[model samples]
Target: MTYATPPRRTLTALTMTTLLAGGLLLGQTAAAPDASAAGGKKVVCEVDKMRQQSHSLRARAARLQRLGATAEARKARAQADALDRRVRACVDADGNAPKPWN
Candidate 1:
């Protein structure tokens, strides 16, 4: 009786496949953020927080406009626009004005 070993080509292919799978796993792990401490808290990234604030300000401005406080409403809208721009910048740190939250 005798035992047969895998051919050289077969071993090579299996090793390459293993290496490729390991690389993919490492790549995915590196791309994901650690969520250990963020279990309970809603982790709003910087760009998202700016977007939410801008949205809230816009709503406030609309309410003020409905209430007849035109001047204050304009000011609030201006602030909101500025914050929106900040969010855009965060989304596209480059000079190119790419739509941030759409």
Candidate 2:
């Protein structure tokens, strides 16, 4: 049998980080979004998702212009951009507050 090393505290920390990253990815995979986590670090995660989606939507809208699908592309891009802006506003407002996050 091969000798295996026992887990240490550092391994626990690494596991926590991996789990957190996975949760963020899963949270962003939903179409409706889990805004329930908005009070914590998950807000940051949502901001990242919104930013990524906005960038992708913008790029797709630009490509659509070349394909002459401007109207639909622009509409969808507007929605994505609105979500991105809201996410940014949440980030800015959260950091500006002077109260607890209960």
Candidate 1 has its poorest 10 consecutive residues by lDDT at: 36-45
* lDDT by residue for model 1 (2-97), tens: 645679778888999999999999999999887654665753348777888988999999999999999999999999999987677666654554
Residue-level lDDT of model 2, residues 4-95, one tens digit each, is 45667678788999999999988778755555764545444377778888888888888887899989788878978798888878888788
Clashing pairs in 1: none
List where candidate 2 sits over 4 angstroms from the true fold. Answer: 1-45, 99-102
Backbone clashes in model 2, listed as residue pairs? none
Residue 89, model 2: Cα distance from true site in angstroms: 1.5
Task: Summing lDDT over every window of 10 consecutive residues in candidate 2, give the lowest-scoring window.
Answer: 36-45
Please give each candidate's TM-score. Answer: 0.47, 0.48
Question: How far out, in Å, is residue 52 in model 1?
Answer: 0.6
Error of 1 at 23 (Å): 57
**Quality of model 1 by C-alpha lDDT:** 0.83
Which lDDT values do the candidates have, in the order given?
Answer: 0.83, 0.79
